[model samples]
Target: MSDSKAARARPIIVFDFDGVIADSHDVCAAACRWAAAELGHSDMPEKPFAELEAVTYEALAATISVDPERFAGLVCGALEARTTCAPIFFGVADIMMELSRDFDIAILSASDSDLINDFLITHGIWHLVKCVMGRDVPGSKTEKLLALKSAHDGKFVAMIGDGVSDVAAALHADVRAVGVAWGWQSARRLRASGADAIAMVPADLLDLIVVQELTEAPTR
Candidate 1:
């Protein structure tokens, strides 16, 4: 392949849905509370999103005394709440549209696929995304990343998210992981999880992707 063609195909940016692109913290928390109450475990501490962000899904289920098997149902309920009124972060749609011009943009989220699709459609950015792999997509994030890497061949892959699981999945797949502080997890937690860099805002994330693409460009 020519250098230009290779460069055009080099970058594949995978984004996490909730917290990263969509501001659904309150919705998620409400869903969690509702799920806990429904499961007869409303006594769990009402922790802040930052603290809760550090906990794995299974751990969260255990923390709330909900059976792991029932966690998906809880998440589905959360999605229903989210779909009713989840707002995309400021500048997210614009940046995603800009980036999609030069990169393969995709979503690797724990959010339901239908919900993700609905959000994209609602925001009119559905066509900008090349793929959408939700939690029910038949594998873990690590497995999904691996599959994406394999499919993309020599493309340079980066995982951008607001959770520790995102960073861990990127590391496991041997790709770059960029954590956004404005998301669900704290910046401190993201850094500790081995994020290649932490983006404090949407513009910062855009700049990071631009810089990475340029740095990876082939020279004559």
Candidate 2:
């Protein structure tokens, strides 16, 4: 294929690192609990994973009457340690490798950039990604998506995540939003959050991407 054609054929996929790629739900919950206690919010009621995943880190901290920045630090520290032990979900590496062959993969996550990078490197898939916009990054995921859209003008973009914020960002950026059921939010919650589609498993995600590529392919 010609260079232009090849570029046109490839889609840009942005992923949320935590719940989408890594099975970090428990790690996140533990971190939240720790932060709550350490920050003197131990009396705060425990929230369901779906509810927690739906809110921004700042909002979650605010709900528990804790300082967002300090809570974020605690969570980040705990998450980094947990991920160092075991990060990537089962079969994620293989699927990421396959997707990288036909897509320009990127990461837009609320997790710390260093932690995300460490997890990706540990799993040997860091090289597969083209960009990573983390919480430490300068802007929100919506802003990051807009910048990516401007850079990759006319190319199809999609965001795969397990959070309501991901879907909201995708909507704000006018891109495809795909939710994963195996992550932090349940499929029902993801659906209610306005995700375009939900993948029940890793293979299902691959199939969803294929279908989206075909559906969005430009007419000759």
Per-model C-alpha lDDT, please?
A: 0.77, 0.77
Clashes of 1: 0
> Per-residue lDDT of 1-220 in model 2, one digit per residue for the tens?
4567655654688888888887776767778888888988776444435676445567778777789888888877777776254468888888889888877888988878887788888778889998888888898788998887656653655788888888888888888888888887778888998888888988887788875563352232
Give candidate 1 regions above 4 Å deviation. Answer: 1-10, 44-49, 52-56, 81-83, 214-220
Question: What's the residue-level lDDT of 147 in candidate 1?
Answer: 82
TM-scores, one per candidate: 0.87, 0.87
lDDT of 1 by residue, 44-139 (tens): 554434665434455678666679658658757666664375899998888899888778888998777888899899888999999999867998
Candidate 1, 105: how far from true, in Å?
0.5
Off by over 4 Å in 2: 1-10, 44-48, 81-83, 212-220
